[model samples]
Target: MKTLFLLLLVILFISGNKPGLSQDNNLQKNLGADNKVKIQSIIFNDIETGIVNNDVKKFSQYLSAQTYLSLINGVNGYYSSNQAYYILEDFFNTFKVVSFKIKETKTAESVSYGKGDYYFEKKGKREVAHLYVTLNKAGSKWYIAQISIN
Candidate 1:
C-alpha cells in the first residue's frame, strides 16, 4: 500500500498535478502573454529634443489649443496654446536647461504620458525636477495636452 501511494504521488508530481504550483505557473504565463508592446508617436521625440535644446517655439508647437500646465510655484491652470508657450519660455529663461530625458512612457488608446527628469542650472547650482507630459492624439496628429513639473 505504501509503495502504491508513493508511486501515485510521483506520477502526480511529474504530470504537473500540484494544485498551487500549476495555478501559479498558469498565472505567470498569462501575465507574460498579456504584456504587449506599446506604440508611441514621433511627436514625443520632438518634444524631448526641444526641451533638451531649450527651443521654446519647437516645444510649443506640440501643445494643444487648450493645454493644462502646472508649475512648481503653485501655479496650476489651463491656458491657451500661445499662453502655454510664453509660460514655458519664462521657465526656460529662469532656469537654464542642461539636459532632459524621458524615463518612461505609457500609452492608452489615444493618449500617452511620458515622465522624465529635467535638469537645470540655477544660480550656479544644478537642480533636478520631475517632468510629466501628456500627449493626446487628434485625428492623425498628436499634441501636448498637459505638462506638469514638480
Candidate 2:
C-alpha cells in the first residue's frame, strides 16, 4: 500500500509540473512574436520620420548591409549600407520633403510591407510619389530590405 501511495504522489507531481513547462513555452513564443511586431513598428516609424525630416542618418539605421533599391521605371540596383546612406544624403540634398504619410502596413512573421505617399518639393515644385517598402527582421532588429518608388 505504501509503494502504491508513493507512486501516486510521484505521478501527481510529474503531471502537475508539465503545465508549468507548457505555460512557459507559450509565454516565450508569445514574447518572441510580440518582439517581431515591435521591431517592425520601430523600423516603419524611423523610416517615415527620417524621410519627412530628411535625416539620412536615421534612415541608414534601418537599412541592412545588403539592401536593394528599385525604381518604378525598371531601374534596380543593389547597395551596401554605406552606399545607401550616401544615396539618401544626396536625395535629401536635392529635395525637401513637404509631407509624408503611411497609407497602409502589413506584417507577417518576420516580414513587413508598407505603402505610403510622399510629397516633396523639388526645384520649387511640389511632387507626390507613392512609396512601397519591405522590411525583414535581421537578428534582433528589423531592416529595410527593399524599396520601390512609383
Candidate 3:
C-alpha cells in the first residue's frame, strides 16, 4: 500500500511539473517572437539599403514569384519576378532615390510590412512619398510580396 501511495505521489509530482514545462514553452515562444522581429528588422534594413543605393538588384533576391507593385506611374498589379526587376529598374531610372528612411515595421501572422519615407528627384524636382513594402513568409523564409510607392 505504501509503494502504491508513493507511486501516486510521484505521478502527481510529475503532473504538477507540467506547468513548469509550460512556462519554459512560453519562454521559448517569447524568444521565438523576438527572433522573428530581429529577422524582420534585418530584412527590412537590407531593403532600405537597396532603396537608398537605388539598386533593386540588391533586393531582387527577396522577391517572391509574383510581386505586386503599386506605383505612382500608374502601374498597379501583380508581376513576375523578372517583370518586377525591369519594372523597378525603370522606376529607379525615372525617379532617382535621394534618401529612404523606413519608419516602422509590423508583423501579423506570417506577413510583415514596413512603411518608409521615399525621397526622390523626378525631372530635377525633389519629391517625397510613402513607400510600403510587404513580406510574406513561406516555410522558414520571408519573401517580398508587394511594394507600393506612392
Candidate 4:
C-alpha cells in the first residue's frame, strides 16, 4: 500500500507540470497576436493622415531609422529617418495632395503592407497614383520601412 501511494503522488506531480508549460506557451502566442494588431492600427492612422495633410513631420513618425523608398520609375534610394522627412517635405512642396485613401492592408508577423490611392494636383493637372507601403515593428512602435509608387 505504501509503494502504491508514492507512485500515485509522483504521477500527479508530473501531470500537473505539463498543463503549466502549455499555458505559458499559449500566453506568449496571445501576446504576439495582440502586438501585431496594435502595429497595424498605428501604421494605418499615420499614413492616412500624413498623405492628406502633406505633413512630413507626421509622416516621418511612422518611419524607421533605416527606411528605403522606391519610386515609380524603378529608382531605389535609402534614407535615414531625418532624411526621409526632408524628402516628404520636398514632395509636399512639389505636389498638392487633393485626396488619399487606403485601399487595402495586410499584416504578417512584424511586417505590414498597405496599398492606397492618391490624387494629386500638380501644375493644376489632376493625377492619380497607387502607393505601396511596408511597415516593420521596432520594439513597441511600427515604422515605415519601404514605400513604392506606381
The number of the candidate with the highest lDDT is: 3
- Model 1 residue pairs with clashes: none
TM-score of 2: 0.69
Structural similarity to truth (TM-score) of each candidate: 0.69, 0.69, 0.74, 0.69
Which candidate's TM-score is highest? 3
RMSD after CA superposition, every candidate: 18.1, 12.8, 13.0, 13.5
TM-score of 1: 0.69
**Clash count of each predicted structure:** 0, 0, 0, 0
Q: Across residues 1-150, which tens digit of lDDT does each residue of candidate 1 receive?
A: 999999998998877754553323433444445555222434566678878888877556667899999977576999998999988888877778889988888888899999999889878999899999998878855678999988
In the range 1-150, model 4's lDDT, one tens digit per residue, is 999999999999888776653323433444563455354655576678878988866566667788887754454799888887787677756767899888898988888899988788778998887889998877755678998766
Model 3 lDDT per residue over 7-80, tens place:
99999999887765232343344455345535566668778988888888767877889999999988999999
Query: Cα deviation of 71 in candidate 3 (Å)?
Result: 0.5
Every candidate's lDDT: 0.77, 0.74, 0.84, 0.74
* lDDT digits (tens) for residues 43-127 of candidate 2: 6776788888888676676778888887533547889989878876776667677998777999988899999987788789988
Better of 2 and 4 by lDDT: 2
Q: Which stretches of candidate 3 lie over 4 Å from their true place?
A: 1-37
The runs of at least 3 residues in candidate 4 whose Cα sits more than 4 Å from the true structure, single-residue gaps closed, are 1-37, 72-75
Q: Could you tell me the C-alpha RMSD of candidate 1 in Å? A: 18.1
Q: In model 1, where is the ten-residue run with the lowest total lDDT?
A: 21-30
